[model samples]
Target: MSLHELRLLPWTTPEGNPCYLSADSDHSALSRLADDLEAAQLDSGAQVLAGARAVLADPGAGERAVRFALTRAVESLDDALRVAVSRGRRIPARHR
Candidate 1:
């Protein structure tokens, strides 16, 4: 497979660069780990959304609480977007 076909992992390196997997298929141990991590990231993002919504609906939420919720929501959104882009790129061109 070409470099274009490399699987974008669910995480980055220590320097915060994107990571990729070069296995022939997505069944390798490392690929499986990546899959698991992606699932966890998505799940965490959903939880963060719920919390953020609750915070937004709370009229008494202080600035600190709103800021904290906003920060977490931004982070979860970034993760979710990364996951989307990675999965989208992995799709076959013909399927597009």
Candidate 2:
């Protein structure tokens, strides 16, 4: 199936293992829920990036604060990666 027709949602199991679900159609209840969650996660990631930039600009920002921001950023990046992977699109090597 074409990537555009698929909806991918990244999630975690109760044990904290990363997981994902994919649906060919977006009208399903699960697909809608996944859409909502993905939107929220992307928004949150943007917010985190802003906050991290602010913290980085502050000379007084402690190591712990920077680490925390980095951690969140990494998690957000992973989520984005999962979303992209679920689309089943082959990213060009030059883009990497």
Candidate 3:
């Protein structure tokens, strides 16, 4: 959860250049965050893939995971949007 919250911090600085967090939190934390992101991406992708395969096997099971993943993604996005808006940052309209 700390790692996820760290990623919510901007990757680019105000000058639009990529930078890292203080040395106290270096690559290890970033790597863990990256791993988490990768896992989420894989989970979302696999959810779709499994759903597709389930369409041939047990339609209900496949539909359930896919719908759950989509719902999670939407909720995560909504939370991010609310945070950004509250912080006075520019958020995309779709997220609003």
Candidate 4:
């Protein structure tokens, strides 16, 4: 399939490569699954951000606590950015 026909899936392969879906329609089962996963990833990122902010605002938060929050925030940010890129690629050229 041509690059424009391929959809960038929400998850990566075990080798850390981007995954693509080549369904004729976006309503395909795999495409729906990817949509659901992307929504979940965004939701999780929001939750992580809220928790990280709480940790940062706490004067008593220990080094470990801060580090853990930072780590989770980073992971969530990565997932969110991946989702954004994937969605951006799917938008029609005219829309951009």
| Best of the two (1, 3) by TM-score | 1
Candidate 1 lDDT by residue in tens digits, 40-70:
9999999999999999999999999999999
lDDT of 3 at 41: 52
Error of 3 at 8 (Å): 17
Question: Can you write out model 3's per-residue Cα lDDT over 1-96, one digit (the tens) per residue?
Answer: 233233333334688664433333435776556446545654655565554555546545665666765666565554444344323322334565
| Winner by TM-score between candidate 4 and candidate 3 | 4
| Between candidates 3 and 4, the lDDT winner | 4
Better of 2 and 3 by TM-score: 2
Q: For residues 24-63, what per-residue lDDT tens digits would candidate 2 score against the true structure?
A: 5556688677667777888888998998898899999999
Superposed model 4: Cα runs more than 4 Å off: 1-4
Residue-level lDDT of model 4, residues 1-96, one tens digit each, is 243477888889999999989877878799899999999999999999999999999999999999999999999998988898888888888898
Quality of model 1 by C-alpha lDDT: 0.88
Whole-model lDDT, model 3: 0.48
Give candidate 2 regions above 4 Å deviation.
1-8, 16-24, 88-96
